[model samples]
Target: MDALLERIQSPAHLRQLSPASLQGLAVELRERLIETVSKTGGHFSSNLGTVELTIALHYVFNTPEDRLIWDVGHQTYAHKILTGRNLRMGSLRQQGGLSGFPRREESIYDAFGTAHSSTSISAALGMAVAAQLTGSQRKAVAIIGDGALTAGMAYEALNNAGASNCDVLVILNDNDMSISPPVGALNQYLAELMSGRFYAQAKKIGERVLRNAPPLFALARHIEQQTQTLIQSNTIFEKLGFTYTGPIDGHDVDGLVATLEKISKAKGPQFLHVVTRKGKGYEKAEIDPVTYHGPPKFNPSLGVVGAASSKVTFTHVFGQWLCDMAAKDPRVIGITPAMREGSGMVEFSQRFPNRYHDVGIAEQHAVTFAAGLACEGLKPVVAIYSTFLQRAYDQLIHDVALQNLPVVFALDRAGLVGADGPTHAGMFDIAFTRCIPNMSVACPADENECRQLLSSAYAQDHPVTVRYPRGAGAGVVVEKSLTPLPLGQAKIVREGEGLAILCFGPLLYEALKVAEPLNATVVNMRWAKPLDLKILQEIAQSHDRLVTLEDGTRMGGAGSAVLEALQDMGISRQVLIMGFEDQFTEHGDPGLLMQQYGLTASGIQQRIEALWPVAQVTSALRRVV
Candidate 1:
């Protein structure tokens, strides 16, 4: 670490560094980020892209004092490095270490905890309002990506803030790619505007000239504004009543700092559109950023460690299932809220381009869009992450569940996501989705089970959600076929004696291990919603102790479903619900996180040993039998 890096032990120390030194710090931070992330193989391009912008923000503004809200927080590694986490960079995403995203508890500099896309503007605006109401002199700055900016909530926030005259800064980091290649004409135009430097320089000169001179300058500025208003097509931000500034170069640290310093004191709802490269520094990442966006572990010196298609992921299973299902069913249509690649709908998009809908960072809109499509008799499969599905709760409840629409929600990354932290973890999907009236929830044990459950969900007309975890399964050889499993049925994977370990999703392995010492029976009750009564009754009658396990919260999860079932039946079954408690799972390796949360095979084994006495032997079995 250099002097600049050494000085930044915390955000308070950042104020000590000069602008030029801060710029140097940004370079070193980027080098550090690249070095660390390249080896760790996590969020390389996003962090590299935001280096200068991160430095400029800290240099121009008072962070921690001034609330800095980062939307879709993949771009926050630079901010983290600058905000006294420089030494802790190596501890990122590790167990008992730092997180990859902005956590409110992690640092005072991160004003809001963010993981989902398209939320910063609204959150920042709320903070701005709160600050004003509380008579605090803190400024609210929402650093959002171009992709996140496309969401309707950002526009809504812009509209409200513009009208309220809130002194909030909306920095649009346009990278031409948001995880994957950006779609729509607005993205293309922004790319064209940012690639060339002349436009920004000329605009800066015009602005400076307008600021210095008097009546004539004001008149010219007015005319210039009028001309821009007339000539330029109404971009999304401008339409929402924001004072649009730039398609500026985000990489130019000095230029950005100066512009921000100028914008910092400016009036209400300012939108600074800064264009950045996705993988700014590293050559390999710059060339192919999509691959490097959220790469797995690799050697920093060797670029990427293995070929992109070295092995199959659970996403691969979903992708194959999607294509196969589409081929089989004419009504099948695929939908993604700007997660075409992540959700494994790329082939579906290609094969059925007309049937495919990439709704661009709008989860609510996507859910409602699918609801509409379902009403028209199309089997709309909205493949989204469990974390992102939280954004469309009302739509999922009101639009689909009430009406009983046939929307198949393929929920990817349904459990504890590694590295991305609490924001990215899909732990709450079960708790939230279970309460809804007509929605059926499905959890698959492995890749094969995931495809089958997806197929089953597709066949249903009552709005089903099939959730699966990230990465590869237990290397189970999945059938190159789409076979719909029996809905609301639990499959008995094992039949033992002393204990019964009932589980949903990927935690079935953990439950199996916990059951091993107790000589327990293991049941993979694939569906959470229906709460397979047959299996529940059988286990209740036969087993002494029934332990429920899931990768979600214990409150309203798979275990909760079993308890609800027992309540309805009026039978007191010894159901010990074991899952992640009300607490949030932090950023770490999924295995380590699972272990920490007692969702690991070993962790479950220990917990079961302690809590295994929930069951009681019958008096008749002891005496008469």
Candidate 2:
């Protein structure tokens, strides 16, 4: 039985398996996924949920030719396994290995790359339209979750797709989740759509009754529509011109295979609503899906035993600051785009439920909504990931920054976020946010500074973004009080002659380590936007050479800002900027990525040695002595 799964090198091989063998293959696949993912620590519960759906899709469709687009891409582990990526599943999310999400370059089977949510419908529609233009018989299937369907983009795609007469099949994989639990009116609507017995009964009756009579087919459809309108309300998909079908059991492989087979041959934009449970096979995951959503490495037999560490993460610091901020300020409100837990807003959400807004998977809406709240004299704190914030760049600029709304963006994962890869990396935040006119970007050196900077940002009149890296900082003691740091000030951490190392964010630690050997002065430049010109002038006057260090991209980043400031002041000794290269950082251990990108102490030391040789420095010291 296990050998059957081994034979499935590709979807072509997958189609060869009998319907009876599929269930057995599915069992084997599930076991393999659990075994591999448990050690590799890839997306857990979502992948577990979609095992059957993935199998059914490949089994039914001529994938690679028939484009299959996965919305959000967390559930595509099974799809990857079926499409000749099973062998490399162990290296999932690792550097120089398979991406956690779908990548077009990675394989021909991956029709479109997807890391973000609500994009499958649009991508699938485009593929279908492209096929139509080329006169190809290929189909485009979009497997979107109810969670992704919450976004307005999905609806917009649905509207356009319905109007265009393209053959795009949208399979709603309703597991009632995104990263966190599904929320808002859309989830409720989906629940209603699933539970409505009248619609289901009427649909069955109409199909049976209409098949016998050719002339009364239109009348039968009319009757079905009337029944739906009266009982279940006119489905949004139906109104948008999709032939809707089923709250079908997604776990039932034979049923899914049969349904998908029929739907493949169907005309126009079709929507098949399939109900699924997150972590269907694994009991531990089923009991608590959120915890198992993206768990670290753990033994499957023993259950989730999280790595024991007393170290406080930057996320925890943000969560503490959020709770404290909400407690003191009566007008303070918290917001996240379906990232309550991820953004460290779970406690804030629990404590101040009224003030907390979880605008599900709608980053654009979340930003503008925060602006609206700010307009109403509410100090809205938008706790969001740096990667996710890219989606709301227009809203941040147009609605918030342009208006100079008093909003605080507590941007978590503001640098090379390990494991999630380049798509989820926060490398662009410093470059992106600093360029905006009314935006003030703060880079904290450590956890304590992170808290202080957050408080400082909240007090500001204009839109302020406080960006912090993922995971634990440099073991700095976090202060309990929310006293703000001096705005646009650089703190000289250590005074030394010859060279200056100007650091931004938590990369200050690495700079300090590199500076120790070089006897370079280390300055923690707190704010990225409002360059500390006074401190820069003093450092420029004192040091023969200056090195700017940051964890973001070198181009248009904090280092670039420093260079521009130095140019404006007409004080250029010799400047060397160090940060991420002009390329997407691959998925790997954060420390390894830092080393590879020349952000680590050893890497920085080598770069500095290249600029001013250690031998030359020693000779200069000897001559001076």
TM-score of each: 0.92, 0.96
**Top-TM-score candidate index:** 2
| Local distance difference test values of all predictions, in order | 0.82, 0.89
Model 2, 478-542: lDDT tens digits are 99999998788889999998888999998898888877778889999999989888999888887
Locate the minimum summed-lDDT window of 10 residues in model 1: 616-625
| Candidate 2: residue pairs that collide | none
> What tens-digit string does per-residue lDDT give for candidate 1 at 324-372?
8888888888889888889888888899998888878889999999999
Question: Residue 443 CA error for candidate 2 (Å)?
Answer: 0.5
TM-score, cand. 1 vs. native = 0.92
Best by lDDT: 2
